[model samples]
Every structure is written in C-alpha cells, then in structure tokens.
Target: YTSALHFLNTKIGKGQIFLKFDTVEHDAEKRLLAYVYMKNKTFINAHLLKHGLAQVDTTYPCKHLAKFTNLWKAARTNRNDAEKE
Candidate 1:
C-alpha cells in the first residue's frame, strides 16, 4: 500500500489530472470511483494494474475493466515468471 501510494503521488505530483466517471457516480461506500488520467493522456488506472500496484475490480462494469484485467493478469504472470527464475 505504501508503494502504491508513493507511485501515485509521484505520478500526480503537481501535475494536472482528470477523472472520468462512468454511468454511476459513486460506489456503495459513497466513494468517488472514476478513471484517473494524467496530463499527458496516461491512463493511471492501467498503469497501476500493469505495475501490480492495484487489483482489477470487476464488481462494477466499466469500459476499461477488460483492459485493466488483462494488464493485471500479464503483470502477475511476469511476476511469477521472475520468481521462478
């Protein structure tokens, strides 16, 4: 969690960010769940998944859920392969 927070802080440091909300605005806990994007058009969500800093949540359907899931799977595979080396 600390690593993820640090990664996010570095990515979001003093830079303009954007959020895109899906059909729904908030989650069950009233937390604002949206797709985060960096100024240079970098998809933060995908990056987090690719780096194994975050897990893909499929509970709520979203356009990028599939892509995020694939990235997460690839990250896991890469990590496992590295561990076997």
Candidate 2:
C-alpha cells in the first residue's frame, strides 16, 4: 500500500494543479476529493480524489458563480482576443 501511495504521490506532483470546489457531500467522497494537486500535466488526475491531497470545489459554491470561481480572468484574455481580431 505504501508503494502504491508513493507511486500516486510522485505521479501527480509536477504540474500547476488547482482546486476549486463546493461543499463536500459524503464523508467517503470528501475523503477522496479533499486533497488534489498535480504532479505532472498528464498524471495525478486521481489525486484530487484521494486523502491527504488538495481538495477544491468542483462547482460554484454560491449564486455568484464567477465570484466564487477559479476561472481565469486576466488581461491576457483581452490581449489574445485583440490579437485574433
């Protein structure tokens, strides 16, 4: 089990992982989604569903979704959109 855990930890520890989530529902599910981070761009998709990991709200937590979202809203979007036009 330790080896598997080690493998999991190493697999998802290499990317700019982010977690934005909502209120946890089930205890078991919460245990799974409580910790989520990326080890790499490809692997670690499952770590976000495991214990001792980075847990984030998968959905908007309130009525104002944007305000509670991790959605990227930087000026870079404006520049890119302008460049396209």
Candidate 3:
C-alpha cells in the first residue's frame, strides 16, 4: 500500500513528473508511486523522493486529506480572483 502520494498543479512550465515505486511489501505490481510537481524540487511523499520531482506544495496529509481540500479552495479562489482582475 502506498504510504504517501505527490502531485502539483501550477502555471509556467510545470516541473516534476509521476514516478512509480514499491511499498513495504516490495512487490512488483504494488510498487510505491510518487509524483513531483515543483521547481524548487522540494519533493514530498511518504518516502524520501529523488531530485527534479516536486512535492504537492502542502503538508503531508494535513488533517487527513486536508491538503487536497485546501488546495481545491485555493484553486477556486485563484480562479475567482483571476476573473475579477
């Protein structure tokens, strides 16, 4: 089972990419998966990540999936703000 996941969404030359990995089981099919998405390359995930791949720009599982919800709100707000401007 994947302990953590990584992803990013931003404008201007998205950095990073999704990488496959194995979990504690160390099985072929059930390899751990990690994706990076940032220029800083501050990769984030259950396990340590490699260079180039970036984290999701959020705290690990903040409040249990909280990061996702927070990101969603931030995206919505950004969209609204962009329209206004």
Judging by lDDT against the true structure, name the best candidate.
Answer: 1
- Output the lDDT of residue 3, model 1: 87
Q: How accurate is candidate 2 locally (lDDT)?
A: 0.41
TM-score of predicted structure 1: 0.94
Give the winner by TM-score: 1 or 2: 1
User: Candidate 2 lDDT, tens digit per residue, 17-78?
Assistant: 65544355335434533223453443243332233232235452333234323222333454
Best-performing candidate as measured by TM-score: 1
Which lDDT tens digits does candidate 1 get at residues 1-85? Answer: 9989999988888889999998877889999889999989999999999999999887787888779889999999999999999
lDDT of 3 at 72: 51
Native-vs-model 3 lDDT? 0.39
For residue 38, model 3's alpha carbon misses the true position, in angstroms, by 7.6
